[model samples]
Target: MTNLSGLQASRPPEAVYIHIPFCTNKCFYCDFNSYVLKDQPVMDYLRALEQEMELTVRDNPPGVIRSIFVGGGTPTVLKPEEMEYFLKTVRTYFPNWAEDIEFSMEANPGTTDPDKLAVMKAGGVNRVSFGVQAFQNELLSGIGRIHNTDDVYRSLDNARAAGLTNLSIDLMFGLPNQTVDMLGESIKRALALGLPHYSIYSLKVEENTLFHTLFNKNQLPLPTEEDELAMYLLLMSSMEEAGYGQYEISNFAKPGMESRHNITYWRNQDYYGLGAGAHGYARRMRHINVKGVSPYIEATKNGLPRLNAYPVTQEEAMEDFMMVGLRMREGVTGEAFRKQFGRQLEDVFGRPLQKMLSAGLLEHEGGNYRLSRQGILFGNDVFGEFVGVLTEI
Candidate 1:
């Protein structure tokens, strides 16, 4: 309610993103700021995370934290007691939790067990998302995924037995040695799980990732761009057929099971980003923490572990609104744009909107601008139009 200044808070972030940067093994395609758990100081890093929370709330007091997403190399790698400590810090620092909070943790199938899942449930984690990249053992092994199809079933069973039902799984297409048929099988099995949510993505080779290294040498077997597009089409249709709503780009859910935490990002709202390499947006300021684990811990020892913090310009904010909001199925509303920036949506982005609308890449209905079926395929192009268009407005 109040900050250290003893006055009412100017703005309190209601969403939280905590990063756990340790994993059993680094996936070939993962470039996220994570380290192998082997010789790393796990508990020490967690303690630093708690200290960061204390320092964060001191200046930027929190409102009701409605969603907390613990993401990582693999959050499930944490021991049960470690998880308990982390959640306790979360509760202690941000006590004003919303009644229907959606607390989620990302798990790698082999890393999760009954005891750890039980710790998660007891700590208010109502949702669990497993990285079940594919159902086929060969495909799973072709990539660097250590968990086979069996780990997926066993993990789901343990999660269910722990009384956690709001489950989701992730699938990736365009992987090395993967076929469209393989993808379809993965989708079928995912749907058969009867879980409430699924996230399907196409593999992207980013710098510093093993996939990137292999790609440069033409050693990585990849689907052709056309094939990748086909995979996306299949993913969308399959999810819709399974009665799951494609709420955002790469995410589908059974109606109310949509990820509220992610919606906060798409809506361009504020949230606290805790832990190493986590990014936060609040009070029109976007900041990311130091990327290295030991460096992050050392940085937080004195104060906030900010690698870089900057205030967002009004133009950038408006551009961000369009870029992120358009990812949602409901898309961007004229009303929301007007409310956030006190400018008419058309006034700020008239040229891009007109172009997209004319090209049939976007559709305007009831004064909202949403991507057309075609626009979703060229989402980056559609977003690119709005990127710098606001600067001159």
Candidate 2:
């Protein structure tokens, strides 16, 4: 067994994440690097992304790409022609899309129409995840979402017409002025969609967002801890009852419909991160690109627009493995950890293991350590005990 830092790999990555930084509008709670689409150099940025793909593949070639996730402010904001051009660039540079590749794109409800969806499908996007945060129009408006419930239905119909059956929708709970009954109604509506997957996330007030401003000003009316917990429990129970498995902390899917691209991330494997403000992990190194639109486009003409790039130390890698791996309902496997790091899991983080197991927050069975039902709520606390225990913070 070896430490996590400098863990060697036998092949290149099979996953690619392309970022499209343009959005119609910024959501109140979003902190993801994105910009308004108006008057932006959309074509110029696409060209830069093409160049980046060429250079990145030349530097470190890819294997058969099993998954490609194009995420952004809203990937569907691209006009049909623009999307065609962008997808062509991807297909040209990364020629080896696996026969069963799961190509996914994030789209807002109003952004995706039949024409744009056709371009996406032709361009290799087989999965569409709509940003339908809530079904209630008032909550949608309060949260800065432009689309109403009608747009949600229209977008789903458009996606179906485009022949994308492997669909997923994103929902949010614990929103401002939202109630338990409101969340339940939203969940009921979402389940009626009969989609294969759903991503339900709780609201987090990150820095530099409108929500943060409201929180700082004491104007935000977030749900109490009890209510938030209740929301989580209700969603979990509802999804399972509806025949979806809670594969990850924030994601649920039908049988064999889990997000492979996301799993590559939780497994701490390598993947290419393309576009402005995108992050990548490869060859024991992690890198983030320049965040600004103009800066990223200009910097790419010279070379890759990397804001920060560094090889992860062994201890840090171990910590990352535990942190992300535990986010899954499957938890971390002792066997897989040994195969990856060449050491026993307990040999590295035995101290935290003893504490979590003793506290009944983590459980071990069949060579895996996963969160118990009680442990799921205290996941952060369990993960924290692993952090800074092996390396300097």
Candidate 3:
């Protein structure tokens, strides 16, 4: 196994991300590092993951992990016994978990059971995010999701029954043949559930997914740009009416319910990523693990697979900070920016900041820079400016 004692002694990681890459079936629009189970080596993969953690974490004993996110294939896909073993391995390596660590796991509607959820809770998972893409059965089927609306309800009920109160639901818009009315219905249903947090994302046709193939063949039916924009607006207004705050561009949550683990990423903080296909940023260096299970397992036997690793230049880090920070409603704290990079935020990005301000896309309030409502609508364009600035600098 890889030895991590040196790395751990150098710098302890504040967060950990573990990727579980086995799914019952692949979704049509998904391009994440996951596979449809057709006699996959589940046991072997878990064993390798445990071994990787033992080696990698030896160097960075995870002194006080602030957050731990277990994302898919589908983390809940593992049997209860398997999950116990997986969690046991994690605890064994990361001996020091933060007192208020935000441990989250992604759950599929159909795959989770109360028993498994209880095991996760006992294992220190406090948050559960359900992939409830839509409330309609037809849309679920169209997207190649194995679970139906009933599955969503049942899963939510089970999570609550299992004493999981800090929950989040993921929703999607801009689906094929989706109308504003249908979108409204979905939003209403979601709000009616009184979930603490929600992530509503507009569908993007990514490469290598079923949707992309259909799009290439001119067979995809998607909402018009204007319609999609309308859907977004409706969602925002509906969420506000239902007393949820729009914290991030695509995320809404009640006060104090924002995802701490995700905010760590947006804030550009250091985190450790484990398992196949996981990416991490720590001590100015960024790294990604090997993608495939067998490849990852073999590589980690020697050390962290680390297909790629690079240091983040100060200029690059600043640009990334600005781009990611602007996604939040509260925006980037000018003081935090200055403190982290040892430069005045405005002085560094003076010209572009002024231009964006003049264009009514950005504003400064309480020593922070944030996107205006219009900027939120055209956020991609605003973020593009930072990318251009980064390239030039």
TM-score for each of the candidates: 0.97, 0.97, 0.96
The positional error of residue 164 in candidate 2, measured at the CA in angstroms, is 0.5
Candidate 3 lDDT at 343 equals 70
By lDDT: ranked, best first: 2, 1, 3
Model 3 alpha-carbon miss at residue 114, Å:
1.8
lDDT of 3: 0.88
Clashing pairs in 1: none
Give the better candidate number (1 or 3) by lDDT: 1
**Candidate 1: segments with Cα more than 4 A from true spot:** 1-9
TM-score of 2: 0.97
- List candidate 2 stretches off by more than 4 Å: 1-10
In model 1, the number of clashes is: 0
Error of 1 at 250 (Å): 0.7
TM-score computed on alpha carbons, candidate 3: 0.96
| Local distance difference test scores for all models | 0.90, 0.91, 0.88
Q: Model 3: per-residue lDDT, tens digit, 1-393?
A: 111223322566688899999999999999999987678888788888988888777755666888899998999999999899999988888878878888999999988888999999999889999999988889889999989999999999999998898999999999988888899999999998999999999999999999999999999899999999999999999999989999999999999999998998899878888889999887777888899988988887788777888877777788898899999999998798876776788888888888888999998888888999999998988887787575565
lDDT at position 62, candidate 2: 87
- Which model, 1 or 3, shows the larger TM-score? 1
Which pairs clash in model 3? 4-58, 4-59, 5-58, 5-59, 7-59, 8-59, 8-60
The residue-by-residue lDDT of candidate 2 on 50-115, one tens digit each, is 988988999899879999999997888999999999999999888998899999999999898888
Residues 1-393, model 1: lDDT tens digits? 111121111468889999999998888999999899999999999999999999999988998889999998799999999999998999999999999999999999988889888889989999999999999998877778899998999999999999999999999999988888889989999999999999888898999998899999999989888888888999999988889998898999998999999999999888999999999998877999998999998998899999999877778888899999999989999998876767799887889999999999999999899999999999999999988775555
